[model samples]
Target: MQRKKIAVIGIGSFGKLFVQYLFEDGHEVIAIDKDPVIIDSIKDSVTIAVALDATDEHALISQGIADVDYAVIALADDFETSIICAESLKKCGVKNIYARYQTPLQMKVLELLGIKDLFNPEERAARSMAETFSFSGMRSSFLLSDDYSVVEVTVPKRYINKTIAEADLRHKYNINVITIKRPITNKESKRASDSKGEKILGIPHGNTLLREDDVVVLFGSQSDITRFLES
Candidate 1:
């Protein structure tokens, strides 16, 4: 993957983690924060740590942020500061911009500035926690829309060795199996038993067979997923 220079405009908890991950993944990162303590804490980890108000376009340009490939405004508490930083970055020709917003008003402001990717970290965290607590068997779940949800479920023992056409997931359960993950073993092994030991988990094709312990990631409505789970 081609590494790009990324700038994170806040050194709060979420911003700090994002910067650390980018740096660890070999991407050049510029860390900016108004707090001297925050800048001091992450100075050694990032490519550049600047202690300046990101709301000021002049200060941001002076800190060499105009040349960054991607800029992320992650100041959750201050909506005005986030908007200013995003607007300035857009005017400076930064192509990729992400911002964290706390409310719908803040999201609308960012949208007006042509920033497409907006995240609410608090809401995401809460949704994740709620999913984990409510569903014990679910591996993961995503809210695609108000009425739709996507979820991953392990195929039960009763559904083993049944082809997709025979199982009729869509007709029976109103769900679509998007993909199936299968484990691959080394082919160069000498043991014939090892070669035959590989098992089919969940076959996703029309003629495919479903087996026990196979995980099926499916997309469907919240009501449909709940109905399938109950059955």
Candidate 2:
């Protein structure tokens, strides 16, 4: 994964997780919050953790917000503060901004300000959980748009031992397999052991054979994805 310099404003519960994930992904994370205690708790985990008001444009610039590749406004419950921080980030020339909004009004306000990449993580999580529960093999799912989605589905028994070309996924189900995530064999003296003592296989190609216990990343309409998973 490519490392990104990210500025996460308002290190609340949601923001803290966001920062931690980015830090763990090997990105340079600047975790900003108003509470010194919060900063202190997360400082050791991230690249930079500062207790400062996010609405202050000067403070944001001082912390190198302009140089960051991405910025996230994580003040979901604090509507005014979230908007103000987003404005400050844009003014400081942060190109990509993602924000969390609690209510429809907050979403509208952010949309009006041209911040289109707004999300409600709680709602999304609930939806994903519901989808996974409804689909037996669906591990996780993300709705990219009204019609499109990216879904992670376990390779069904019928697909085991089939090559990507033999599966005929696109023509049969209208879904595209972006990549396959196969579990690594637990052998001693292996090169790719993860920190958790597990390893994932590399991205697969057309000639690659599908195996049981593999997770495939599929991109297509929700209906098509459902059909493929069900098939």
Candidate 3:
């Protein structure tokens, strides 16, 4: 894995996870929070853990955040603090800034400030839950936008053994099959082997056949995905 210099502001639950993931990925992580307890808790887990006010631009610059490859503002349930942290990161010349906001209105404000990447965990979870409840065949779903989603669905019995071209998914349902994941049985393994499960077969070709146990990854608008799954 290529190592990256990442700075995370606000050592809340989400921020801690962000630091953990980056650090586990073999990247250099700098964790910042106002609370000494939070900073101390995550100190050993990251490259650097500092108890500092993220809203202070001078402090951010002094910490050499301007040289980081990416900076994330993970202030939870606090839009004002998020905005100040984002402003401080921008002033420090951090090129890539990812900010997490609580509401749609906060998203708009962040967008106006030229922050392209935004994360709203609560909203995403709610949307995914709604989709799961609405569609029984949907194993898992991810929202790309308000109208678009990527869903993993069980192949309907009617489409089993059918080729991709025969299904005409794009024309009939306005969805595209990104790839196919098929369970591969390992005779040499024990009853509960982790590697005895499904694995991606890369991008499928036009003539790729759909098997009975094949899990397909589909991408399209929400309505189209619903239509495809329901059929």
Candidate 4:
């Protein structure tokens, strides 16, 4: 991904994590919040942490907020503050503004403010909890046991179109591929994903070709698999 300068307004729990992840992805993140203590807590994790009122348009512009490529308003608990921060961002000419909303009405209001990106943390958290309680085919996505795990993910971009042996995932990342599934063209199907052509390429050999659309089942130490996907 191309690195860009981004600003995160609100150094609460939600914004703190958002800044951390974006910074980890090699982006220059500017952390903004009104609380000096909150800003100090996250200062080391970001490129810069500013203790300023994000609602003030002048204060934001003084920090060169207009030059930022994107800004996220993560003041979920304080909806009023969130709206004001968004207005400041808009006036500063930020092209991308991602806001957090706790309810449908809040989402609508943010939409009216010209924010195309809005998220509901409570709704997402509820959905995630429900999924965790149910039996999912993709449950192998997590730890099957303490020591090992099974994961199903699409072939990495660097590994697409390469033979299994060529990728050398087992040698480099210590993860072994257990199965592969690829869609076969069906003229009557509306989309390739709905073709009902799921076939388990059981016991894949070194010569097996990895396609762009292939989903592979892998088994290995969770840490190793994570390294492989991140690599």
Instruction: Give the top-scoring candidate (lDDT).
Output: 3
Q: Of models 1 and 3, which has the larger TM-score?
A: 3
Per-residue lDDT tens digits for candidate 4, residues 54-73, read 88999999889999998888
- lDDT per residue for candidate 1 within 1-231, as digits (tens), equals 799999998889998998999999999999999999999999988999999988788888887777888889889788888877887887777888989989888889889989998878787667756775676567777776557877877776667788778878899889998876544566887986675333444545788767666677789988888888777
Using TM-score, give the best candidate's number: 3
Instruction: For candidate 2, list the clashing residue pairs, or say none.
Output: none
Per-residue lDDT tens digits for candidate 2, residues 155-195, read: 88888999988998989998888888766655564465542
**Cα lDDT, model 1, residue 168:** 83
Q: What are the TM-scores, per candidate, against the unseen true structure?
A: 0.70, 0.84, 0.85, 0.62
Candidate 1, superposed: residue stretches over 4 Å from native: 142-152, 161-211, 214-231
Which consecutive 10 residues in model 2 have the weakest lDDT in total? 192-201
Colliding pairs, model 3 = none
The residue pairs found clashing in candidate 1 are none
Candidate 1: deviation at residue 139, Å? 2.5
Candidate 2 local distance difference test against the native: 0.86
What range of 10 consecutive residues in model 3 has the weakest lDDT sum?
A: 186-195
